[model samples]
Target: MNHFTICASKNDTHDIEEGILDTLAQGFVVEKNDSSYLLKSKGLFKRHQGAIHVIADNTDPDYFAKNMPGMMSFYHNIPFEDEQLKELVMIQISVFNTVIAVEMDKEITDEQMQLLIKLLSSIGGVGFLPDGTLLDQQGLVIVYPNGESGPSNFRPHACTKMINVQEATSAQGEARKNNTIAFLVEKGIPYVASLPQLPSVEDCAFKRQEDIAKRAVALLIAIQFACDVAQSGNIEDSREFFLNMLHKYNVQQFLTDNEKSFLQAQYPDAQYPDAQEAVSIAWQYEAYWTLIWALGFVETLEFPDDVCDCDYAIQVVSSCETFEQFYAQIAMRSKEEILDEADKIYRLHWACVNSRINGQAAPLALNESVVMERRRALFWMIGYRNEQWDTMSMDT
Candidate 1:
């Protein structure tokens, strides 16, 4: 059976009217594979159904048809939001322009232009017209006006400067050029061009800067621990005196009032948030990468805390496996301690990080899983941190 008859309305005394209303209400049921709404039946009422249709997909191609409004409402009724989406559009443009610039004078297709407009519309404000004309926030005339025929000109590159209102188009272009040079400088770590060696990680320029910053944070935290040990006065007057001496020498200018307070008051029990701690880390990172070209070695061999008690991996170790075990295995230290003992741990941990960076660190007792576990443990111990992509300038 291709189709069936039905009553269109119950109130209508006329059989024809009743059948018409029922048939419309019963609509069509689309097959799952078609990825379309309504199975649109064929037969007697087909002509009438087409005539009375109110939400036909052909009416507005702009409206995405895959998931109808009713279907979307089931998930959430709200529409899209966010300014980052606009930035992403710009990033995409950059990627496109770079490719085109290298691939010769290849122009974006009509479909590409439509997609760009759709993406820009989702981001809100000014967008490109079907013919590549730019629209302002009020959807009025902008730098490149639109006409009935289409856009007057095609300058996809201009879109990059439109979002960055802070900088003029020329300024933005110049900034991008500078950023590219800076990126190169970062990659050529231990040197800006041929001079001024930059002590940073071995990778892209951004990665190098990030690695230096983390090392700086690690050194700062270790300095704080030394300060704590000295303040306790239990170790030795000489030990306390030496710690204070190093503190004055290394971390004075970089330490904020709040950080100093934390050192004086919170010491071991204190909880430090990520971004705030990153500030201090950034300070040391700047100095370390700039001044110190040659870095020391760091080694770590993460093992279960109870590894000493048993030859096999301990069940308790599954819950509280620590990196100190790795340090102990290599450093010849039998005892274990918290991360606060960074001064004592740095010798081994530094060796681990340095060796890994230099490809000098060799695999120990464990397989890849154990290696990954230990790497994570060492990350915290070495104050490993990821760089924010948005923060660093991109090569224009």
Candidate 2:
């Protein structure tokens, strides 16, 4: 008996077998005696003369891709999506998978990669998801992070995260407005110049780079921490925190009426709801600015003085191909075993940035599996054993 691998466009078992037959009928013979590639189709595949094994991705892809190391065959189909310069686009289409990418030994710069993805999207070769991945019309993510499903029914769309804390500070609001445009200017992404300033607190939301979704889990923690601090911290703490953070981020020009009134009040006697809202707002003001600045900084590839050393981070992330490998090494360690939460988060940030820095163009993120796993583990580690922060509420 021998095993074979089917590389199908679809993610179904029956379709894969039929695809194998079709491919075989087309006179494309399997070079490797032990393995084969099949596109997906419906109906049972005619049994071969001898016993053979077949496997697929979705469940089987990751397992075989990793475990069946010695029996590996790389298949990459380059979809021609960018038609900007017809001939220029063809030049890129010739380089499909990593093996070819590596074989060509051609290094594309980060700027070039960004432009290429945009070009591909224009040509219908890819779609940009709010999740920050590039998908084809068939819903297969052309460029995705590590350990994720490539095909889906859901179409991609531009994503914007609205920071709608009613008590938000001026800095938070402007981060939604000014800094976003600033970032566009910084990154050279074209946008209309006279864009209106964001109106509602909800308007403070902006689109993010796809790789930043690792924060999907961490966001719950931040929200909870804000809620807790809001409930427990004194008015002085809230007022002082917001005031300090707003000034530090220099967003005082954009302060909200509520935030302004609260800071100006002589004897800050805000009610419970108002107080909590204030704390949450203040935290968001600072947090959003910091996040925006950090993300923008990463685009420059120059580590901010406030951030860790890039050389050290590059050294740390060099070994990780996927976030899976990176997590396997760190997940076992207790909170004390590693650096603080900031360090861990930053390391993940670096891991996400690794491919982009290496000229891989589209920065893929950590898979949802790893993101959810980290979320669960961090919840327990943070001692949030209570049901309050369980899956349901946190997910919202």
Model 2 regions lying over 4 Å from their true place: 1-13, 26-57, 60-184, 187-305, 308-396
Provide the lowest-lDDT 10-residue window in model 2: 96-105
Could you tell me which 10 consecutive residues in candidate 1 have the lowest summed lDDT? 96-105
- Per-residue lDDT tens digits of candidate 2, residues 1-396? 121111222223454344334433332232323333322212144322222234433344354334322111111112223222223222222211111000001233343234333333332333333333435534455444332445443332211211221123345434445555564456543332222232333322222332222232133223333454466656556656655544443435444354455454655355444555545443432233222223332222222223323243333323544434433443232222211332233233333333333344322334322323333333323333232213311220
The residue pairs that clash in candidate 2, if any, are 15-40, 15-41, 57-61, 145-365
Q: 1-396, model 1: which lDDT tens digit per residue?
A: 111111010111233223223432343222222222222333354221212111222333233222222221211211213223333223323222100000101243343234333323332334433333334323333332212222223222333322332222344334433443464355431111111111122211222323333333334343334433434433333334533633543434444455444344432333333344434333332222221121221222233121222112222112222323322222222111212122222222222333343454322322222222233323333333332311211111
TM-score (C-alpha) between model 1 and the true structure: 0.23
Position 342, candidate 2: lDDT: 23
